[model samples]
Target chain A: MNKYILSKKLYRNELATFYSFLIGFLIALAVGSLILFIQEKNPFDVFSLMLKLSIGSVNSLSNSLNKAIPLILAGLGISIINSVKLWNIGAEGQIFMGAIALNFVYINTSINNSQIYILLLLVSGFLGGAFCIFFPAITKVLFGVNEIITTLLTNYIVFGLTIYLINGAWKDPASLNFPAAAYVSESVYLPTVLGKLSSGFLICILFTLIAYYIKDKSVFGYEMRIAGGSELTAIYAGISAKQKAFFAMLIGGGFAGLAGAIELLSQTHRVSTGISQGFGYTAIIVAAITGMRPIGIFLVGCLFGALTIGGSVIQTIGVSSYIAEIIQATTLFGALVAQFFFSYEILKKDEND
Target chain B: MIDVQLMGLLNATLQAATLLFIAALGELITEKSGILNLGVEGMISVGAVSGFITAINTESLFLAVIVGVLSASAFSSIHAFVTVVLKQDQTVSGLILTILGLSLSSLIGKPYVGKKLEVKLESLIDIAEPSNIFQVLLSQNLIFYIAILLMIFTAYILKKTMFGRRIEAIGEDLKSADSMGLKIAKTQFIATCVGGAFAGLSGVYLTLSYVPYWTDGMTSGRGWIALALVIFGGWKPYRTAFGALLFGFLEALGPRLQTYGFEMSPYIVKITPYIITILVLVFLTIIKNGNTGAPKNIGIPFFRENR
Candidate 1:
């Protein structure tokens, strides 16, 4: 009889981690297939159809790329703070705050030029998102409040505030009670790369490079890593962990805010409660899957972008669109589970330690 | 001058608080066992959808509640495996469970949208007779009474029972408890399952007794609110119940204030409860240390030295 034992790996293996990620995604797809089968549709055809809709054609690919822009930016934002051991769950609220800022400028100003107006709106968005997390970061450092709960609570507040503005104060008289702010002027719209793709996609790539440089090469990143790795060590070395936390969170919030601004200026053309489309929450999963690496965030962000577009595609094929969410969530869960295998091994009985 | 209408509002507050208290009390126990399960919202969504689907088919509330508890517990067992057995990070694992729970619930609940259950449990109050303050207080559904009993029972067990002491010991110092020969993993796993069950019950109550229909994302942020209440209560079961009631009164206050003909946006009114929760948390943090009333080893996964 053959015997097998599971034991801990002596060292971390990158190859194992990579394989586990693929296997995790495969498992998630299998689960998703079961959901499709339950709905009496062919899972293979649906998957292929999803692929076609998201990346198989120029038009659909452009739409998917547009969606990936915000996700990539938001994922990058989450990655920054996550590296610092601070979970900034307020990205959703920050995105909304950014939209609010963008709309404030759009409504209150007549900067109808393409070049200057877009730049101002983008800056305001960054500032708006940064302001949202400023209080939580300061409170976390000063009062020792858990940023998790505070950030989450802030999301609900922003959700309610957004709804209020859309339904009341910011409701465009031209929208005719549709509960949406007025669309931005045509010149304010983001320029297209191709026919339908927005310039926001290029900005996403640029931000990814910038985030990579900040995370890997910069002094602030070095200090953040040391502080996140060990507060005691950081304190002993005279690093102000509090300051790093504050700045890291601010940058994180700013990236997500930028996503919100791009979403408004490029795709939606107006502010609404659904501008985020839960990207803030989904970005967490993307950041985690990528191990908080900037480039990994971009690729995974696009995958999720495809998943979401596929979800809407499934809706037209008689399967519930939420199947996309199931797959997205399951993939993350499976990845976490697969991580266990990379770190440890299963052993048969009577195997010597 | 408080009128009968105001008494009715307070009465509604009690009912709302009952659901929060039930979930918070269960979470209090889980935290006492040193596991922080942030997937309370996800568990409730699954429980609510499963319970409503079962009730619609069986026309039996008891069976539906059982199904709710079982499915939610079953779902949380995945969390138990990840956090307890694998010794993974609790926050990430809990968040994953929440995403899965919400997605799965929405997918399954897609069919049941806009469909009403046949056996909805209305208020326990009989409307045939004239109402008074006492009647208004007692008019809540069966779950309200059960929540009160559960609170007292949980408080007693945690304070007096040997099992509770062992779990509390585990929460405070897992290494010491393990050295003392206590089964840390088993106790924490059971506590998590029980917590998941209670969250499920809260969902069933919401669907069966309160809303009487399944709605996607209907649990909303209530599970998160329950998590906040557990902390606001300082980890004491009875105190947590009080916190839940206070939160409920604050939530109930929003709609009541609108009745006075104020020009406030209803959406702004909806945000008051969340804002108040934040204020209370900030106040508590200022008055006491972050670790005050919290288990020392909460959120850390425990690993045994050897098999």
Candidate 2:
């Protein structure tokens, strides 16, 4: 009996990546259209309206950018961890830790100085994220524990703690009994930039560049590539693969933490359970769809930012905001399938042939 | 008085453990076949919503459970195809399946939110005395009794059946299994799909017997916990069932503590399962190989080289 077989291509197909993105995008759009049709709305009209809401006006653009800021930073974080093949799904928890740390510094300190406050917040946020991930990272390195479930479990605990803080200990006396932390001092709020945009956008860009440099060019990056690609090869090269894994997770966590801090300082002045809006989770998709590249993550973050802003926009047309989630998820599935065809081709032949 | 309270806690544990036990046992099958499907959370959600919608429309518990299992299996089939047939990364595929399941379920479930169920599975017996230990033990929804039977049957099959040995062989040494003429892909696919069906049933138990209402994202990470329980239970059916009960007891303890006027925040109590899981991992690591019970090649995609 003879059958068609799948054979892996010898060389990488550069065009495969481009085709994958296109296919994934098309699939996402198709899903969105189907959902819209079910809702009895013209898919094209809603799509155009969503674009307008996300990027049509300065106000909308600013909102979109604000939404994208955390996503970009968090995506970078996910990219860092992905490079080392460490599945740390705890970025959401790290973001909360960062916010908690930033708030701790802001409220506990007597220093009302804006410059010092911002500087301290950023540092504390990074440390907070790094600290939160240290447990899983160390456990993985030393004990061979799987970071995936541990990190995922840690997320619920962090979120639970966040809720407890907002409702009980950290409740803002001035919030009029609302379950939210007190707003940051006026001086500590992020300064405005171009037409309603926060300076946080610029910081995100800066971090993106920094991440690119560290991931693509730095010695640490070289070591990480070796460690991630093959542990034996890295060990033979005299590089400590375990150390690299630990540091990768640490840096990744820090990036997510910083994202949390920026989101709080720039957009939401007070901490609440809804502060994240699942940016940590969306960032994972952004990182994956972009192949975990820094610049690509930024672009994907922008698209997701648009989706986030547009999700609420479509609600006016009676569509559930969950459409964005569906589209995002579908895109990932399509992309993964597309990635399969990149290196292998299936040949069909008669079984008797 | 204390006996009554203890009995209530035990009763709650049975209900909670039954759902977790169903999911954990399914995952055990999937893992034993060397495929790690991490999308249990998403599959459970799909099952919950689908079963709920079915119940709302048909008012038939059996139909709802069937729909729930089928929907979850259909959702998980994507993972099975990608990981088994395509030989893609199991972890990433599992995650994408999860995200897809969640979004798709929420999309379909949008209309059913807050809708009261037309019918739900009823307990097999009614206890005249709420504090009767025997009555409390016996009087539970059909699913709970079914779960116990499933647990025993699964244990028996795994320990005594040729099919179970084949699954174990494929998981432990795929190459040997393939050389031995075992259908590796088919076995793994069937295992993962069956695992998904159990997870789906877990969801049915959650919505119909437990909450008896339709809500978005109702499973709420119980699927993830069940995955961890697969490890805590040493990948054995009986041990896993015991772990489920342990988890169930912890889950029940949280609410019971609240009822008892414990000053601790409910949020802290809610996080106990996760913390316990972490501690369990650490303890396992300290005592032995942390992942000792995991099937070898659990996440590796099998590819036959022409050699």
Candidate 3:
């Protein structure tokens, strides 16, 4: 006859999050190494090669940064919604919708000034993502529907829609049978600031600063925090919990959309089926591992960006690029475990003695 | 000719429904026990690849099914340990499990891409030439019959058994269930594992009977649809089965409609399941006023001391 009690610690150990992330990251590396070993590859050589190719030189680093741009934006988007305790797991679809919208503008408009063209495309892109989530957000607010399923379902719908567009209306004639839209005008390409580093990197950092200000310092964020913590408390404090949630979802969608537009302008130069490459989904991991901190998302985004680039680079060596995804997922699991220990502890107790 | 075409459509519908029903039923059990494992997609992928690999290696459909189910169960245990043992956020943990499952399967299944399974599950009814609709329906693989039996068994268990009551009790109110000498963590963990097993079984069906081959990302988003079916069915076994059949009908309608001279695009047909899920969710929410038969304690990690 015995009883054990699980108790929450009175004071939060802030350091635990950092330590858990470190340990979790290391665990993911170990798992990745084991997988490589199982495939008869030298784990040490593979690891070192990945590191060298991803971050060894300026050009390689710039490539990683280019890859990180969309992740940073999408991660920031997910982080914003996560702060309000909402799951916007449809970021992948949102990214697609954003690209679709940007392409729509490109096809319809005949503007000569690239700056105005880019600005308009960005707006359309943001609107597209927002439009995709609008139904789910509204339904959640009005009918109390679970946004997670609704949002996730929308991803499939958008995916189908994207395929439809690329295969039909947007299919480029000069593409020689490829199912993709025509490239934007040459002037519309985003200017590179460094060795192949698009200005999108600076844009993402700017977004990070703004998101940090809004999430941590603004009155709106404080109210959102209150709403997320307890609706009743928010109501007592005269905050409209529904409004906070609705707007937060829209902003999250907008961020994802902006990411898609930036990717199109700065990198892809055209809307294709392969535009996103799971950036939105990976961004969720980035957001979680960073504890939804904007700056942390930026840093982790770069790391993942490098991992993704390195993953492709190692394909020449006969390794599966999915190793990056596996490591990322394992790291998230580690963080989850770390989060558990950070807040609670188990104690043994004697009963009826 | 019309009769044959109708029967063909019916057969396809049944096959697709079988896939969704098994997975959704597993999810229903897990949700009923207060765990929402969103990693069903990953589990299905793992199951399909693992089962395909096993079948290719051992050339035994039975052993492939067992390995598939066992591997998925073991894969899902990671979610159980994190959410049940460590008390982490179920949604986040489940999502992570999904990411892990998907990538791990793709990585492991890399070399096996384009490989075909020589072993096949034969139809239970050995009518060399079927003369009637009933005979045609009866000529499905053994797994099809097993799925029907499972549906009935699940309905009965949830309606009439104490074990089912324990699951519902834990889901509805974990604190009360815990206080009443119920084994909270054990029930949830087992339910989640059982759910994973069902997903694995579904995967086995895909590789062994449905397609008879392995491909990367083959499961696609069927796992997500299964999750939606659980909601659309309002957490009841029979209703969930009905929802699965409805989805199956949509999936079957696509290729059939094209054959029947309908001018619908395949992409439009592909999206019907997802679109219907959202509409049904909305419709259910409106009618039920957001009180759909979801477990009250679902997705919330339970800790006795928190009370």
Candidate 4:
């Protein structure tokens, strides 16, 4: 009897995610094929081509890993915040600031310790992101302003301010008309580990695992989850919402900031105006779709990583990668629709039970 | 000394004020009816691009404006359907619409970049070049007049009309509205569509009448400014106009201050709108931060469960 129950529980767990993911994948395939049909392109050919580009070759896997780097970090950032029930929408700004700070260091300081260099970038990123969250959280707590608007608008500030800096003071000497700062020294840049994969992907893995451990095994995680699950209960238990919100935003900003710094140091090795490109915003989707699970985020990040690689190949093949965007938008719509079904059942009523 | 520059400033201020004023007024109507539309920015961008495109294609400015309004209304209708019918979370769904609209506009409107149009010039005022008096008082576009009339009408309707009273009731408590036999969906949908249409027209004004050009991100945070102005106005129509005017003056002040050759850093002046927003939000919250000012059901999405 116990074996039967255990087997059933295992079956249910496997079946739940299996069905949900199957539904998600089928919807994506159907939509993708529909678009291809309208364009008179063969769906099977495109699908095969996308698959080959994403994983059929060594270079494609490397491309996907590199693309997955920021996404993994972003996934972790979203996972961290959602644990505390705080939506950190300003990850983009934090990431932008990280890139800016890293550029400042890259242009100004000359460093030779390549191993320790990674630590410097990570710390700088964390601090920069925390700074962005400081004023916004203060305003939300003290003045009753919504952080959603304040955090979102901060993106504009980061953009305009960075552009102003690059245009006026930090313009690369060789970039001519375009406003980009100087690239980092080779010593400061992360070394490529395996087949075009930057060491940044390893950093993402380390951070994500650390984040998972902290969330699942730490007391801070418990306190935060308790606070998030029941604010009233937390208050009754003497936890302050103000403090929780502040701490949550701080941690959230720090992770995002670290992601940003690493992105600059490892990938571009320079700061530019287009540093963010909605990584922070997309992190929210990643977090939501992963159900805020650190492990689930790991898998989802890789899937998106593959999609992005596939998209690049499509772009090279002379098609706009807006097909990818349409897929993302539809997936978002589908996920939200699916949320209603996760814990609910619809059945026809009958006299016989 | 103040009068000479002041008159020119005032004229510019009035013109700038009219565009956002109409938007804030319309937003006020919906918010007062208890629906906060975060899709305002997207709707505005669509309106501006659509209006600009239609004007350029047709060469008839009036038809362009109509197209702009209708285009926004059509998009806004989706917002109404999603929130009212589907019962999805308003905040997230609205933001998604924004992201989608931004991408779509960029994708679709890529064809119009760098193209110029013969903008039908509306006389701001038939001001003579030599006379400073004419420059200050006589020069103004017809849209400015329409915006002022809109503010007056919005204020009057919110207080006087039976429909306005129904909106107030619905906003206060949708259950009460339903108990009184009010058509909940119809009222909310109409209010939302009207609000969206106004937001659209406001965008159209930005592109066609004020600046006759189509550039990506031309709205440039103006839609959000209109949202803040709604709060700054205490959700009242006339006050909303005043807030819009105040913001307009602040916006124009950045350039004038630059022209005056003061040794101020451009960054400080450039962030004038944000600084103004912060100050206005602080002031409003301090005075009426309590439940006294904001509409009771402003952010809460109504569910048709009880009634």
Candidate 5:
């Protein structure tokens, strides 16, 4: 337990971490470069432009922050689940369920039920995400089917459902044959405190803190990680793998649900086919880049959000946003490979030396 | 509703089932040998695009499928390299491969958009040609038959063949299998590649006949659904076919419900398959006591040295 002795014994391999990140960036750049060349554009300009657009001006910064909000929450959702060693690839489906829940509260409320609507929105959003995720939780606990495939398959089916809704039940009466829904009441809307800045950004931060607290401080969090580290040992220690997996899935789903609520209440004010468009999916990259840690998740989440915002700017600059996606994916690849060094110690034998 | 139309429905079901069946069969083999290729979806997408581009440019469906399977196998080799050879996480590598495949396919497929394709299909056999039931059940695209053939072959290889026993043995315990002179790396490598090859064929079916046109993400969610169906079928050959048909019926049923005059909302109906998957999966779990009926080391990446 001696601090100095322990410090010397604990080996941290900086080289591995550095190389992993470097390797990721290189591979990502190579992959993205293929896209860039296909677009008949210079890869250097696209990469440089992407950086500029993401962090260029005050206005640009605001847009990036707004987009990053949902990603941060969704990414943490991924991290939280990973910490428990359960793969919840259905964040996309959970978000859809969350957005739908938020949308329901938005569209069903009477004009007078504004305050009530806000409360209902939060509750419904949580339910939407948790409910979508609950299906996979049951399967993992009961059938022992890998949640990875089940969850992803469910995500697809959920998209079909979303498409059905917009084209059917939730079609905006006022719109001219567009698959959209009626705008939520103004009173139910989440406010924008900064100019053109979304309030959902705050929601993202709040969730991150909650995740950090739950993972780092709570006994359950410690047990969850222990379970992930070794399921057999955890079981021997009297931890229920089923319970751990179930709760992990639920929390992940719930975070995605809240993200949906924030989107419905703050941004579009309605659900459309565009309600998805890969925000939930991109959260995976954020989660991985952060090394599945909460605070680290915040930084990486914002970075990815900035990529989207900046990618959008490139579209305006006559470069396709497709480049942005390539960059984002590549960066994730780069970041994930790089972060490994931080997690493991590299050992060399004297014989080798 | 389930009477005379069973044949035509059967045929369409066969076609649809064949697409996923091919890939699922491959997935089954690999899983049996104890390496989970989570990149099935990505590999399928890549195969679809590779087949579409090559076949469309050449106007030969057979060549297209070959390219599709080869390309898919090649793409899958990357996954095998990482998880099997390099000892990376099977799930993560599979996912990364998926992401990479999707992005790469989308990027590569962009140029082929809005173009018409021409493929040469063989003349139908005269016996099944006359009867609707026969036509639906017996006559299908060659690939459909190929898929069935692969399934039977897989069953035979796994249950009756020595190689199959070795695969099962490896799946049960890698160390024991290796100690018994099993070529662990070669068997795993071949199994993963072959599994990937069928997944590629499934993609080719998508581009050649199902949609018969090239579009981005045209496989939709079929890859993942097929993967799920493989599990729901309890990883058995006969059951896999039944499961695929069941899934095919539900998927087709979504559109068939449109014929009703009530004007059902798409959202509620669209969720049918997903909801059913959850319900059935949960039910199966409760019935089986949360133990997987799957290969023991299904998702654990393989390394011979470690064993």
Candidate 6:
């Protein structure tokens, strides 16, 4: 057998990503099977059960679709910043702030018009997420601070704020010592399109389409690509790297916030500590596995949503729901490894010689 | 009464600081070698659960710590291989590692939750009567002393040793380091493992000595805090230790103040560390004119063929 060497590819190969994801996804399933085997369960049985529960029925599919809404929005948000090579790990916190901001508007407003109130809530949610990321963005642009740590740190701060509000100012009088905000007024609740599926699905799809257009076909996206590629290159090309980074990060934050808002208005209907369920962090995986493409994010988001639903379904059979998270993370790792092959091709010893 | 309370406060501060310092020092080492491992949180969780389970079964703190450190080190190799060999994005890989670690821990540790461990690492210098503040400070577990020693050792290695120089050179400029015949991938992989080992040790300290029990999300956000402390300390060993202690004091102050009948909200106290971290980042940037002592090639993947 001849030795093989990794040779760098001169041109981008789109099919590489597709193959990588496919192989990565299979690897993830293998790993998940191994975990199930270790737990004394039939991997085949569990896998089939998960598949059936996630998309086996129309109702289950709708539930999975509903779950995908937040993931898609947050994934899109994270993807925008990823384009600029910026990490927005604080989407978790941005979601909290968005929920809080939407609740704040609901608690104070007396608006009875459904359309106007829903619009107001959605905008507030977007603004809330942008506001959450404002400090990290400014510091990164102005002071050269690491956005990753700053953004992650901000999540904890926002969690604290959420707890403070839930326990003090926004605490529902009827909650009776349990810490949570009052239910959002029905006037602003997102209309349900099907069983458990809300109109937020359309909003998320619309947002993804818009994001795709801007990121792929617009000058701003072109400039962001340049800015993210290299600061020197961006400067040479007359693009303000700092400004682009700041705006991209803000937009990312807004998307995360909007995710939180939609989840609140459509699903939970009240601000609680468990509103996010780590959706923000999971979105990072969704965004990564999809190669930060808007359309791919939507598809991957639904896949993960199915996995999440499958996680809960498996809980009925003595399996922990954390299986979903484990599988998701493993998939991302597998994809990262697979992506390496995309950038470099394997050459035989004779070929190299 | 005040004197006793003050001593207790100092003790709690030191305990908290030890946990943060160990993990932050680990991160500092990894970052020093030009690899940013955001998976510190995940590593700590894996270590904590594995160590806790081992302590419960084996009833030996030594074995527990070794198991914790080894497992975490092994887990970190995935990161090393992906980032160093495969040349993937360190940030995304590290984040995924965190997710994987945490979920893996929770999945495996599900059986061991709330089970108490009989073996505990007790204070080495158990003074029956501590006469002064120094004695009070000295009355900490062997791991606490080990943390201090590790800090000193880290400082020495970074500032004085050839290996340290290699790491610094690779982190600062990989191309030049490669020209000088340094082993970039090997040094980085080892450094990342060492970092993982330190994080594991931190987790063992938490389960065996500090809280001495297993709980879901027990490490909470301490891993993230330790990451911030690395930056807040400006990536220097001693300064990082100092920053850890300062944050530790804030952490300890919350419960102590409640006991003292202070009405400050716990939420406010909890957020203080994060807010202060951001402020410190801003302050450090302003004072140093944006030249924070981060490793220049900190998160950039190295691909020799491309270069």
Clashing pairs in 3: none
User: Which candidate number would show the highest lDDT if scored against the true structure?
Assistant: 6
In candidate 3, stretches whose alpha carbon ends up further than 4 angstroms from where it belongs are A2-4, A348-353, B126-132
lDDT tens readout by residue for model 4, A66-158: 777676776687677667666666778888887877666655665677778767767888888888777777776677675666676676677
Better of 1 and 3 by TM-score: 3
Complex DockQ, candidate 6: 0.77
**Candidate 5 per-residue lDDT over residues A1-353, each given as its tens digit:** 21211011255563553456457767777877776777788878877887887778777777788787778777888888897788878888888889888777666665467667677787799789888888778767756766886778778777877777776688787866676777777888877867667777877788889999888888888888988889889989999877887898898898988888877787777887666667776887667655677887787677777878767777775666655566666665555544443443344434422
lDDT values for all models: 0.85, 0.86, 0.88, 0.72, 0.75, 0.89
Per-residue lDDT of model 1, residues A1-353, tens digit only: 42754466678787665666687799899999988887888999999999988888888888888888878898898889987898877788888889888999778887646699899999899888888888788888888887888888888998888888887888888877467887888888889998689999999999999999889899999999998899899999899998898899999999999999999989888998768888888887788777888998898888889889988986886878888878877887788788887887766767454
Cand. 6 Cα-lDDT: 0.89
Chain A of candidate 4: what's the TM-score?
0.90
Could you tell me which 10 consecutive residues in candidate 5 chain B have the lowest summed lDDT?
B122-131
Model 3, residue B211: distance off in Å is: 2.0
Count of clashes, each model? 6, 0, 0, 5, 10, 0
Residues B121-232 of candidate 4: C-alpha lDDT, one tens digit per residue: 4766576441465565457766666777787888888899999999888888877887898876688788888988898888888888777787777776677778878888
lDDT of 1 at A36: 82
What DockQ class does candidate 2 belong to?
Answer: medium
TM-score of chain A of each: 0.95, 0.95, 0.96, 0.90, 0.86, 0.95
lDDT of 3 by residue, B119-210 (tens): 88788877655556797779889889888898899888877999999999999988789889999989999999999999999988888888
State the local distance difference test value for candidate 4: 0.72
Rank all candidate structures by their lDDT, best first, as comma-separated numbers.
6, 3, 2, 1, 5, 4
Instruction: Name the 10 consecutive residues with the lowest summed lDDT in model 4 chain B.
Output: B128-137
Residue runs of model 6 more than 4 Å from their true location after superposition:
A1-5, A348-353, B127-131, B258-262
Candidate 2 lDDT tens digits, B92-200: 7887777778778888888888888778798888775568768887779899888988999988877799999999999999999989999999999999999899989
